[model samples]
Target: LQLNVFCQTKPTIEASTNIQFSCIQIHYDGLDKQMTAARLNLLNNYWDVVHDFSADESPVANYTLLYEEKAVQLQSAAVFQNSSVTFERSKSTVLSTGNLLSENINQVAILFCQVDNESIVDDPKEPLLMILDIYRQLNVSFVKTVQTPVDAATMRNFVNPRWKGSSKSKAVMAIFIWNCTDNEQNFFNKAISSNNWVGKVNLKVGSDAMDVIDEVYKIIDSNRS
Candidate 1:
């Protein structure tokens, strides 16, 4: 039997996150019904993919497969303070797209939370607040933060590098931090509005992050339904 399983169409996942298997496909080569049943039993005994239900006359197959796959840990932090960031629902997108990196090359919706504040260059804690606030707004439980270092020989190369690899992708609420200018913020606004695939939380220096809670909630709520 050939078993192919997919948790999310775009399986990009952060560390310490849980994924529900949404699709599973099994292929058998010239299987007899009796042989297939026995094979399934053997597979179940080894893999435990199916729950035992022999006590009942007929067995029901469970659709969802709970897969807890943790990504490689890079960085982590905890959010103790509650989030008070508000979102501009009028400008929020219903969805965002990312390269699924799957066999079928499908595009999937991705959630992005960006904290474009110059303050983070000096005080990293400020960006953490922004990240935690956005996650709280999205109702995603706080997990340790993680980042992949750009290993380049030179500063220029590190700043502008090309990628040639595939990593697991998932439909998830993402977080980002940028020190943006007024023109850049305008561009970000326009970009997110134009592309329904991404929702952004813009944070400025010294602004009350909690002020955006209602706005953020509205955007997340709209997408939830």
Candidate 2:
């Protein structure tokens, strides 16, 4: 048994790279380079070497590692040092959003889906309103309205593909404004269960917009795999 490479060409020749193993063949266009994280993922490796285990201090939960002398008293932004106000106002959130939107269109993006007004709950108007406020404030490229729940197949058409050979490209993420309706919930659950999409996305449901965003951010932070 031996690793196989069916074709080889100069690096400047950006054509497809072909690989075969006797009965099996895989075709990959060599136009762009794969990112380090994705390359590791294909090798069945973890994104964070410190993780790959079930622990409370998983990559996302644990603070980013920094090296300094106890000289590493472990200093973070004062805001992050406190528990009550850690997320009350986060510079990281603002910075990440700005960077994502400002980058090339081929890269990162946010898909926002607004649930039908009629489907909205009469209660929890405050939380809904907050979400609306953030929506309005965002430098939106596009807003899609879903009158009813949709299957994952329908969403595939709009979602930009993420995992390509291009090192520069990234996954398309989405913010779904849920009305806490059973039908919508069921639709998403079914779609997730099917899981046939090419580009991967982490869809999390929460009571408020903030909660879901927080959860999504965690996934995004650790999604190097």
Candidate 3:
């Protein structure tokens, strides 16, 4: 003969919000006796056992089983210190709504922006000034700048082939400015050729300059990849 066992639960308070699990046990008497019943009896009190059974010289018996409820819930806090802010062309400003000021949390602030030579050609120094303005407005101590090159060599080496056709000249000039620095060796190393002299500007400010540059490089590399 075949025996089947099943278990279920009655509805409880809706606030319980916990998951419930159940199981059932069946006992066969044809090939078992008191010795088997003793072992089964020992297991009856286990927390995991919803139900258990024993047969008194009978061929079969069935029992329903159940288990304690278990549940999982997710919770989070809306603290700005744990969040990040980003700036893109589509947005008018780098500041995110309600995130401009800090109450008591000290944070590592970063600023990143891209500018083309054509956009600031009238005043070649405007790009740097714009960056400075943003730094002052945000009270940020660090700033990192990335220059995209337009020259054929730079285009072939760094700039994507797709962008080369549209603004090849601008990309090369931007790269030239980006690589320039007050140090003669650093400036020479980045120059297009030994004969083509490029001017360098001392833009490094405070101890945070290096950190800002490193962060900006990471963002640029990530975008390129």
Candidate 4:
């Protein structure tokens, strides 16, 4: 099974304004067909898709088993913080919308699906990893900067492909906590110094989502010269 996600990019998303997501699921392995259930999910520190499932399909697989929907909403402004402060967030009913149309979409959102046949891929691992892959391929990027400096070091070791090679033109910005340790603070500085990408910015942990977006715009503007 393969799943792809496409979103309606917005110039501005308000606290109660709606943002849209379109999820497409394809079955190549043939182990599953006809989605038994589907959902719009939010990504967190553990990327827990199971417990975090929201916007469930009405009547289940009613969409011809394609796993597509257009009614996902922004619900409230607070959910947007989940992406920036990964480790600090607590599990709760942070995401829920029965396709009735509310303002739920924020900086981070993901999709998940379950097929009628449970013979293969019962967990959310595939979809979660798929989103990560999408993030890696993007030319403009944003990451919460990691809760611990050690995690940052681990991420550094993992490396990003766009940050390498001769044509390092992609823009990436890291948002860190205000009280982040010195090592955590230095991670982006070191990464920016070592990477050849167009430019990189480090945002304080408490910075607004718009702040990160603005910094990314600045990097883009600087590179335009």
* Candidate whose TM-score is highest: 4
Candidate lDDT (C-alpha), each: 0.28, 0.28, 0.29, 0.27
Q: What tens-digit string does per-residue lDDT give for candidate 3 at 29-121?
A: 321234233332211112222222233333433432222111112233344235432112222122111121233222423222222445432
Q: In model 2, which regions exceed 4 Å deviation?
A: 1-169, 193-195, 206-225
lDDT of 4 by residue, 182-207 (tens): 66335534443443211322222332
Which portions of model 4 show Cα errors greater than 4 Å?
1-179, 196-202, 208-225
Of the candidates numbered 1 and 3, which has the greater lDDT value? 3
What RMSD, rounded to one decimal, does every model reach? 21.1, 20.8, 29.1, 17.5
The best candidate by lDDT is: 3
Model 4's alpha-carbon lDDT is 0.27
Model 1 clash number:
21
TM-score for candidate 3, residues paired by index: 0.20
- TM-score for predicted model 1 compared with the true structure: 0.19
As a TM-score, model 4 comes out at 0.22
- Greater-TM-score candidate between 1 and 4: 4
Q: Count the backbone clashes (under 3 Å) in each candidate.
A: 21, 1, 6, 9
Model 1 residue 92 lDDT score: 17
Quote each prediction's TM-score: 0.19, 0.20, 0.20, 0.22
**Steric clash pairs (candidate 2):** 69-72
